[model samples]
Target chain A: MSSVPLPSSRPALGLIGLGAFGRLIAGPLARHFPVLAHDPTASDDSGIEGVRLTSLAEAATCPIVVLATPVAALPEVVAAIRPYLRPGVLVLDVGSVKVVPADVMRRGLPAHAAIVATHPLFGPQSAQDGLRGCRIAVCEVRGDRSRRVAAFLRSALSLDVILTTPEAHDRDAAASQGLTHLIARAMLAMEPLPTRMTTRSFDLLMQAVEMVRHDAPEVYDAIARANPYAEEVRRRFVAQATRLTTDPVQERDRAA
Target chain B: MSSVPLPSSRPALGLIGLGAFGRLIAGPLARHFPVLAHDPTASDDSGIEGVRLTSLAEAATCPIVVLATPVAALPEVVAAIRPYLRPGVLVLDVGSVKVVPADVMRRGLPAHAAIVATHPLFGPQSAQDGLRGCRIAVCEVRGDRSRRVAAFLRSALSLDVILTTPEAHDRDAAASQGLTHLIARAMLAMEPLPTRMTTRSFDLLMQAVEMVRHDAPEVYDAIARANPYAEEVRRRFVAQATRLTTDPVQERDRAA
Candidate 1:
């Protein structure tokens, strides 16, 4: 393995939650900043070079800390890191739903600590090859550190950053990610799909289904129930499907 | 285009519908046999290179006749061409749902006429690039003509021919094609999707939505409602989705 770069004046980047996503970003984050990560469930040996699996306190003390826990766990995680945060330190949480985590960060973190709530629009499946050109949504909750983070993501990781509010993110995600995972789950429940005699559309849906089929239960909860707009979006989608199957003529006429 | 191939000992391939699909297959089918096509809506002169736009009676007289009509129109179409069919002529209907068309062909067409129900899985959108590896499901209804058609599809058009029963086709299709178009329609109804913040899964869904968004109402009707199994598949899918959004933890536990 390449030796660690010469120590720079920039403070270390702390990463919490060494799950799939945390591990995905660890190497790239470690390349730029000395990454100290901690996960209660994870063993001491991460196998990823240059990453130091440290304590929660040590992980929170860095100038830039990324909380990569599930949205359900964000409240307790935020509380745990709140006391260890230094003034003006940037604290970002990578959660699927923005509003809940954004609010959690706003209420739990100190005003002096910069809070940026982000949802990396991809997971391990989508970014299997690399993170270059992947999308990430950044919602500024506390301070003006979004631009700095955006610049860092763009330059260091080559991510396409979308700067928006937590409300806007959740609202749009209701139709995008929320509807996507709902379809995936519903289709999985309706299992034993035809392996042969598949069309391009069915194949595409299968690919999308494969991406989210193994997602965590908490992740499903976050996207399906936690986001306020997701339920309504799913309702609208189901109502439209019902129309297509029930009054197909009227549905077709409207679509036409 | 190169000059039309010499007339062979084999009789002409009669196409009784000159709609988009009729036009799509005309060029490829013409390469193998003299294509005699007729559509009440189409003009006498087809823009296709070698296909002869002929009368319904003349088109039905050929040894191989393909009924490329809507599922709702199959009864009348089968009846209209019944008298003109030559003995042992191959009569096929290219409809989305198989059971209805298979029944129509069985009851309406002559006993001596060979009947096959086919569903070309790819459309103009899915087959935009080419039909070399596209899928076509062939369900034999009467007589032993599926091999004849399968050989033609495999050798002439380079299609992937899936041999199965009309019942099997409809059963699997209700979940695969029916569910697919339903999702596309529902997503389209939820319009103005965030184009900027899309994941690979969402993007794949969007591509699928794009594929079926412009499908004709008659086609949608056939796939969504006409197939006997489609309504049940759709009902189960919606029930699962409702369960997911309303009680995600319960849904997750059940799935787990």
Candidate 2:
């Protein structure tokens, strides 16, 4: 017999979505754990290997479960999978915003089930090269499984993991991811921008914009609307931009 | 005598206004021509070799004179250097804006003077290491000397040169440079920005902001106010940004 463990022998991981993000992680995750992926709306198998396309309840019965659904569907997904979670099972979420997902999973999952909220900062375009060196924020809502998750992310995936609270992650994400998506959206709206006769800075700015240009509309919405502090940060940026553009001289004076 | 030409024996280039930009170009151009630099408000030597800090009239008498003064001071500078320009003398202005400076120099300078409006699309911060591969826009306002200047820029400095009229240069720059500075300014106002927990895209965006953060006030002013198309571009960006932030969901619908 071969020394490598067969797909049936490896520990099973229930992945509860086969959307863009779910498919993105499935390939990498399947290397460590045989992924039992479940998505009610998925029509295609996505050509993913080492992943068994299965039913939601069967997928949820695995010892480890990952809710990779959109931020808006967290509550319902949590409720749907609650009946299948075994005691001491590890449950995690991959969402754009952490605060709401952490709350929903914490309130919905059984107390014996461990919950860790994560947000991978890089998208498909950026991670097109690979996921190594990418950033992911992990917050432990229940149990001490966060350390194990961080260890796995560090050793197995080579990811930069930040151990923070739901509130801290959301606060920082509101300014970082929220502003990034907002600016990317604004720049995209002003398309056909000058490509020739450009500066290094403008090129860099456009590169950043290009990275997020193809992200799903729901991703932008979740970052800009779902996170509580996102609106405030965006408002502050807009006010600053308005004052700077409307009376540029006054803005320059203030900046000086 | 040594085979190397003595500093005094080399052809001279008159550089007016020894501000940040003036100092930046002094060393590079000093390699090709001995620079006669004059700044009325100067104090320190800046430890630059092969440059003589002389009076305005003496510096203005060089075969090739470069106006490195602020855009606002272009009119007076052109008028002051009018009587000193010799026949067939190639005079150039290194200002951020082109149309007004081109007009001012063309009307003020003697017809014998060859007026070429140039904008080196880089600042001290961006060119800290060196100027290889930097971009410079060359606009021929008066005579045929722009072709020679373009060849020298490409051969000697390894710069990418774009040959265009003053109007086209201003229009493209108004969008590229104007929007860049506007975004940089707004981001700066929201300082103490997150440096840690940043994605590659956010890092790229911040790096672009950092590249132009230390630019002189005149640079921003010239790009934003002097370039005629700046106001409309700024208004468009602001309107898009305002709508995106005020009701992000509605903005998402519109974007869809």
Candidate 3:
């Protein structure tokens, strides 16, 4: 039942979740659509004022709904929003890993709705300046709207849109993102690292750590554990590290 | 004998052990002082052309001598050059680790000689463009020439000069440089990493690897082995990595 809106029409966009990433994208997205934002944790004490806040049902009634909640909460969010989603509503998700969230959205969303799963390859730290060069991976889950979405991302937002399936994105990301977070975590545990006599390479490595050190704990959880291929990548990394640390060839240099 | 070469007067400077680092500094340094370079392994077929390469004795007889050899070779080079050094000649070393090499140059050379132990904290890779902002640590070993050397480095090359003892330089560098090379080595073992769909942090981390990946094998040997504090740093890094890899609490996120 999910049908295309008028070609030139811009309908309201319902944004669910009000975390750091939620606020980062809301302002830019408001340019194209009237955004109705909702967050379960936002209250009088929360600093979520200024944006147009709405109830869950009202947000779901919009022409487009984006689930910005954590990946672990995707299933519950999907289930809660199901009863209120209008026919022809397009649902999208912004999460770190794609495969699990894509499946959850596909299984729980109303059959009449169209689903496009996306993983914006940047965060508040990386996109602090702007989103001109940021990349986002878009996968068509339940409908044919992903191409149109990717086109809008390229034209309106100046985003580099990579159209890939859930499996492919997770596989490549397991090695790149999974290893990055793991290394950053290990380094953070060894804080007060030397800043005085550092080489250029060490400076670069520390900058990488700075980018992800303040991220929410769940982000690390998703990259290192929630992703399907993360365990295999971690196993290979730890194995190589063990070999380097224990090898007798390395020992010969110790007596040099 | 190296008397005060007179203010604003530049004399011949000898440079020993012409490796990658030696060749890097020779051109810039030659602009200030007449350079005579010596490398024991250089042959006619080697790419040691276009520079004034001379015998070890001839190079060591200059008013000032610099040792650009690996730290592991510092003691031997110090012994071999001792008989040729002129009275009151100023000697300097550019090595990754300082304490051992500083000790070697101190004990082996004649008491009349002046010694300044320095680490350039950079390489051909980091200084590919220029050395305007690069850092060099200068430690006074035998005489008061380190102050003059530090001032010269500041005025001529625009280098950021850090004056410290060999022990302080090695202690900080053991944590910073030692871990960088170790991480780069571990990542190189897992090559063919994903170039597509990489996050910005991963890109920066890979750039760090590119900076040090092609460095000479002896560089790693010296940093990891010749430095006395490097073993403790490596042990701590490995222990933290092991705990992260095996922690039971992290397994809960796996079920998410």
B197 Cα displacement, candidate 2 (Å):
2.7
lDDT digits (tens) for residues A160-190 of candidate 1: 9999999999998888898888899889888
lDDT of 1 at A181: 89
Q: Estimate each model's TM-score.
A: 0.95, 0.93, 0.91
TM-score, model 3 to reference: 0.91
Comparing to the true complex, what docking class would candidate 1 get?
A: medium
Global fold similarity of model 2 (TM-score): 0.93
Q: What tens digits encode model 2's per-residue C-alpha lDDT throughout B1-256?
A: 1123344766688899899999998999988997888898986464687777777887788899999999989999988988887777899999998998999998899999999999999889878888898999999998899999999999999889999888999989887898888888899999878877677788889999999988888888889889988899999998988888888878668657
Between candidates 1 and 3, name the one with more favorable DockQ.
1
What residue runs in model 2 are displaced by over 4 Å at the alpha carbon?
A1-10, A41-46, A254-256, B1-10, B43-46, B254-256
Worst 10 residues of 1 chain A by lDDT: A1-10
Q: How close to the true structure is residue B77 of candidate 3, measured as C-alpha lDDT?
A: 89
Candidate order, TM-score descending: 1, 2, 3
Give the residue spans of candidate 3 off by over 4 A. Answer: A1-9, A43-51, A248-256, B1-9, B41-51, B248-256
Deviation (Å) of B223 in candidate 2: 1.4
Against the native complex, each candidate's DockQ, computed on alpha carbons, is: 0.73, 0.72, 0.57
Best by TM-score: 1
